[model samples]
Each structure stands twice: as structure tokens, then as C-alpha cells.
Target: MDMERRTLLGLAAGAGMALSVTGARAQTIADGGRAGPADPTEIIRLWPDGTPGGEGVTVTPIVPERSTDPAFHDRYAQYTTDPILTVFRPERPNGSAMLLIPGGGYRWAVLDKEGYDVARVFAASGTTCFVLRYRLPADGWAAGADAPLQDAQRAIRLIRSRAADYGVDPKKIGVLGASAGGHLAGLASARTDAAYAATDAADALSLRPDLTVLMYPVATMADPYVHAGSRTHLLGETPSPERIAAYSLERMDWRGAAPVFLLHALDDASVPVENSLQLLTTLKAAAVPTEVHLFQEGSHGFGIRLIQGRPAQVWPDLVRAWAARLDFPL
Candidate 1:
């Protein structure tokens, strides 16, 4: 089954009709509730409110007319819905914060499996977790690569602007993405060659992240090993070879870039293991502090899910440990 949802973009006084599409199966009521780990510090629900009136913070659109495919809800519809982040403020109010980007191949967002679960883990420990419900490329192909990245930057900026209310350390804000989301997370972390332009009050805030967590991330746009879906999304059709190289992780400016934690599985087919390899190499070469972990046998997109006998899904724990090591105040 294919399901599509279209959202109207109201720019100034103009109405822009962008095909905001999603393809995924219908999500059951059970999909809304998470299984493990629950703590209620501060829960904030969001709506489509642009700027004037909304929740404590608003995730404004950086770009208008983003694509949302016809089958967006049918194929991977679960990711399309707006999510209420299960906020976890530290007992003593740690200043560090993280925005979790759940992966769905840019088609769906595994919000519960990756986004909420991971955020809960961090909030329980000592970090504020803001789960990012970013806009995906309408179609599975690279039709809407930049949309997600724009959303990511906007999310960081929003958090930073409201850091005081959220009890988060603006300087300690970090970003985490699973797969395609990981690619966007990396894009937000790295200094891309794409020209930085000011569009709105939101644009005035910096897009750079303080830290990044990439799980099975797509690192390069030019390399064959890099996920083609990711490449197509970032670089549209017939992109010059130079642009392709410029989009690669190795090509970006890593100086003063955020610290990164990368995780991937060796036996994954969706995205090759080499993607993480090249990224870690680039991070290290750039002297950006990073931590690399490669499991022996897990496959792709298995966020917070049990695979082997032990807890292969305990990635949140590792993240908690890593965040503590950063030594940033709450």
C-alpha cells in the first residue's frame, strides 16, 4: 500500500504547494508507545505552528517546498508523524543536550526504536534529549537530500535559542543520527561547502553542532561504497564530480568540528561497513576526537533492537558513557 500526505507551505503571504510525500505502512497505536526505560522530566508536544505561537520552542522550516512523496505513509509512514520527545532533564540539571536523529533510509524515521529510546537513556543518565522529527526526501531516491539537513540545522538552532527554558547547555548540544539521519547529522556537524545563506531569524543561529553520534552513517557522496540513496539525496542529478567529492566526509572542513562517535556493523548490506571506516579516518586525520565501534555480525537499521543473546541494542549506554566523558556541564 502507498500513502501520501501533502502539506501546504505558506511563505509570507504566498501559498506554496509542495508535494510533502511519505511512503510507509500504517502505524498501529502500539507504535506510539515505547517498551523499555521511561522517565518523565519535561514532555513538550509540538504542532505545525511556524513561529508566532507554538510550544516552548518551534522547529521552523529552513527551506520551503520540501518534497513529500506519494507513498510516504504507505511504505514507511511511521516516521512522518510529529513526535513528542520524552524529555529527560538531569536531576541536578546537567547542561549537555542531544538531538537524536532516528534513521529510516531517508524514507522513514525509526523514532521509537532509535529516537525516543536513545533520548530516554540520555535523559535518565544526565543529558537532555530532543528527538528530531526531520523532513525526509519525498521519494526514496535523492529527490530531497538537503531538506533533512536543513531541518537538522534548524532543530539545533531552535534548541540553542531556548536552551534556558529547556535546561540545556547550548554549547553542549550534540546531534545523533542512525542511517540516513546519520548522514544528515554528519552534514550538520561538518562544515559543508554549500554556501551558508541567511533566510530568517532561525538562520541567524549557528548550524554547527557541539558533538555528533553517527550510527551506520553514510560518510561519502562520491565513493561507491557510500549509500547511493544518500548520495542522490545530497547531490541532485548530474552533479559535477567536484561537487560529489566536496560532499564526501573527507572533503569537508573538520577543524574545530564537533566530536563524533561512530558505530556500524560488519555484516550489514544496506550500507557497507566501509562508510564508517572512511568517516572515522577523516575525523581522526582532522584531529577531531572520535570513537569507533564495529560489531562482528549485526545488520543494518537495528536501532534499540535485540539481535544476539546479549544487548546489541544497548547503544544508548555507550552514548551515555561517551557524553559523560565529554565533561560538559549540563
Candidate 2:
């Protein structure tokens, strides 16, 4: 076998060993071996009154699940019934902010690997981060696929409206998501109308993100290239053609969509690299400023884990450089 392939296998083995040692102790060591207050700096409810369509919805607590082999343990907190945004402020303010969305195939939110872990990195880079724990559609919370999108739109508007309070520039706010969360981010960027009726002043603010970062995102809900599990979870077993076409972000209107930075592994079996490719092509055709990084290895869901070495771990640096070029209000 080639040296690079061999090296990847060795790294995988090392990760396996680490997982074995850490999987059982995931809860205690979730904060990267550092102990801190269990509560977030601040937890702001998305809705002040009551969530629309969430009147009689029942939500189960999000219990962390350990992986058996190829997949390692993802340390997520309890699933919350009310949607909220957990604030993580930077020591040095850059005037820019990001809404972090964790992916769990519309069933749950991967709050640790994809949410808090990513927030810490960006926060250190001088950007305020808000990790969104949105309501899942698979739990039968709201009717159809509207539940997750509504929460996502509300989260963006909330952050933008309160930009002054959080020491953020309203024009420099962006959205970042992984897998299914990526799909929601793209939807929030492209869709112009509100998913739910505006009940308060927050909804009056725009939900569009100034920029977007998608890590191994599920870009489409259409046939052939669609991730079956995500599509099934978001849309029911049999969805109308109109709904499918509407949710297919690559096929959506890109007129007011934000510039995007996409990263996907060539060997991503979960969401497939084609998902990123399709979105990139569409963005390029629409003259949207876009950057994409496709690694030869790394599989999927590697998230902040440096198991794949320099090539895969350099995504955050690439994003930093990309943001610099944009001259964001940092």
C-alpha cells in the first residue's frame, strides 16, 4: 500500500485506542480534561412567550451515546425542549460572531464535537460564538420539517438583534454548521421569507447570515445525491416534490445567499463529497464568493479531532484566512 494510505490507517488505529480509553469517561472529560461550570455563560431562550407550534410538543432528553468501533463517543448534553442559544464570549473581541449549529441527522444535536468544541476554537480567534440547541424534527415536535428551520431562523435573528449587547457587529455575523446542521444553515441563508409567523420584534430582524461555514454538510434533499437518513428524518417517508425541491439548497435561489466556506472529505461516506461539490458549483455559477477544501482521507465527523493530521486539521486556519480576505469587521 502507498505510504499515505498506510499512515491514515495508523492514525485510525491510534484514534481507536484513544476512543477505548476515553469513551467510558466521556461525560467527565467532555471539557477537554478541564473542569468548569456545567452551566453555559448564558442561555437565552429563542422565544420569550411560547414557541410557535410547540404548544403540545413533547421532547425527550438528549442522552449521550457511545460508539462501538469506527464511530467514537460524541459527548452531547441533555436534549432541551425549549430552544436556546448558549453564549461563549471571546476574551478579545473582534466584533464578529458566528452561530454554531451541531448536526445529528435531524434526530438530535451533536453538542460537543460539533458545537462547543468548534465554539472554543472560534472564540479563541476573537469571535463571539453562540451554539444553538435547536429542536429536532424527528421527535415529532412541530409539523413536518418546519421545526428545525424555525428554530434556526429565530436563533440568527436573536443574535443579530442583540449584537450590541454581545459586543458583536450586526453586519459581521455568520452561521456555521455540520452535516444536517449545514443544511439548516444553507436554508437560513437562502430563504428570504420567515419559516414561522413573526410574533415578536426579534423576528423583524433579518435571518440571513453575512457568511456561512459548512463542514461535511448535507446540501440537498433531492434524489440520487441526497443523504437518505437526513432526508427521511427531515422530510417524512413520502414528501411532495415541491417540498423536496424547496429544501434542495443547491437548487434554491442564490440571489441573496451569503458567501460560503465548505470542507468535506473525499471519502465522506455519511454525507458524500458530492453534496459539497453541488453546492460549490451552484455558488460559483451565481457569482457567490466561495472556497472549498476536499481532503483525500478523514472519512466523516472528525470534528476538531486531529486524528487525520495536518491536511484535515487545517480547516480552521483556512477559515481564518478566508475571513481575513473578506475584511469582516473583526
Candidate 3:
């Protein structure tokens, strides 16, 4: 096979063991009772009793799919009525935790490419990774535009509450989000306010991530820089000015926020690079420790897939370097 073909094949091989199976409700990952390379150590249902703001709204069951073509292996799951954390534990953990949030433009969650695939990479660095399968706003969530952020907040608290169980230091937790998911993380980092009403004791735990990493995020909800699909699904077509200001990360109040690391491609056709640029400007103004990398290529979200000649392929390793540079234990 040629280099491109080989790279594609390698990506497919990375996900095959875990992506081949199917399930209805949240369950442990297994492939016909056989061991799988990418199977999560645990699949934790975030809301066991009932999801807040989910009353009267019928939730759709999760449906996962992967393309048959080896040339283009795409793995994703949609209609996530049950929000869960798919845990990927490192063989030799260094007591750090990272919450990986995949992006499907807020329509679905990219399970393998962004979730499982990226988890293994971080896991290799002795960092425990939690791949979050959060609730989508367009899925008729009663929380509307805030539904996704609510789920994000809950996940962080849940992890912090059981920090010992996951073998992670409670204070060393951070978040990594791609595309629209980045938008959610960005908003969450801006303020320590609660996204939903307190339901359990876990809610008392902080939702602020110790560190924030955004990959080609949709940071703005306003014109000239908004990712239309993410905005429409999140805030609807005629969102009020207040709502727009609320979701736009660059325009939000970010004082005392956690340090942010951003990655974006100048040639990205999906989300404008200015989204990160403007956000970078805002973070500096607020005195938030920020680092941004703008690549000439690496078009869009590839999630650790080593494209033959792309500089973005090195992002996976760069995470550990960034953490070390800032004296963040990894």
C-alpha cells in the first residue's frame, strides 16, 4: 500500500477492536467476549436516576456506526440520550486526568477517531483519559443551548468526586475538546458558575478544569467567525443578543480562568481560524495563561491520525510537553 493508504489503514486498525461491537444501554465494552485493544476500562452512566432538564423529553437511544470502506474508516455515535464517561486508564498513570470531548458539530459524538483513538495516545503519556459522550442540544434537550455545557459540568464534578477510584489527583484534572465541543469547554472555563441546578453532592465539586485545550474550536457565536451549524444547533436561528454573548467564548468574562492551549489550522474550511485568534486575544487581555499553535496545514479535525506529512500529527506528544512546561504534573 502507498503511504496515504497505509496511514488510512493504520487509523482503521486502531479502532477496529472497539468499534465492531454494539450496545443498547450503557455497558462495558467487549467484542463478542474477546479482548479488544481500544475497549474502555469503564462505561459510567452520568445520570443513573434521571437527567436533569430531561423531563417530558423522550431521549433517543444511542446508535453507533462505522463505514465499511477501509479507505475511509469513520466511527461515530448519535442520539446520546444517556450521557456517559468512557474511561481509558493508563497502564502507568502519573495521577493526571484529561476529559476528552469529541465533536460532531453538536449533532453526534465521534467515538473512535476523536474518543478512543485519542484516549490511547494520552494514556501512553501516563495520563488517564475520560472520553465523554455528552448530550447534544439539538436532540430535543429541555436545557436547550445550555444542555451540552450542563453535561460537561456534571462530568467534571463526577470525575472529581471519585478521583481516587480513577487514580487521578483531584486537582490535576483538565479538559480537551474538538470543534463545537471546544466551544463548550471554552465557555465552561470562562466562569465557575453552575450550568444546572444542584441535584446531588457531586454538584458541589468545581466544574472548572485545571487546564483547557481546544482543537479547532468554534469559539464564537457571533457573525464573521461563527460555525453556522454549531450555532444553529446550539442557540437556534434567532438567538437573542444576550444568548449570543453568553456562548461566545472570546466575549465572555474570563478572569481567573484556567490556562488555555489552542490548536487551529489556517486552512481549515469548516471553522475559521479567527475563532481561536480572537479568543487568544481575549485570553491575553484577561491575563489568562494561554498558548496557541496555528499550522499552515492539517485542514480540520483528524484526532491524532498521523497524516503522512502534516505537522499537526505531533499534537499528541505536545500535550505532555505543554503540561511539563507549565509545571502541570502529567
* Per-residue lDDT of model 1, residues 12-67, tens digit only: 11221212222221121211222333323233322223311112332322212112
Per-residue alpha-carbon lDDT of candidate 3 for residues 234-320, written as tens digits (9 for 90 to 100): 888889989988889999888998889999989999999999999999999999998888889888786776444578888866767
On a 0 to 100 scale, what is the lDDT of residue 70 in model 2? 36
| lDDT per residue (tens digit) for residues 152-256 in model 2 | 899999899899998899999999999999999888888888889898788899889999999999999987889898898888888889988989989987875
Per-candidate TM-score against the hidden true structure: 0.71, 0.84, 0.88
What lDDT is reached at residue 260 by model 3? 92
Score candidate 3 by lDDT.
0.78
Model 1 clash count equals 26
RMSD of each candidate relative to the true structure = 9.8, 10.2, 7.1
- Highest-TM-score candidate: 3
Backbone clashes in model 2, listed as residue pairs: 62-79
Scored against the true structure, residue 221 in model 3 reaches a CA lDDT of 92
Using TM-score as the yardstick, the better of models 1 and 2 is 2
lDDT of 2 at 58: 67
What's the true lDDT of residue 203 in model 3? 88
Off by over 4 Å in 3: 1-36, 70-73, 306-308
TM-score of 1: 0.71
Model 3, residue pairs in steric clash:
none
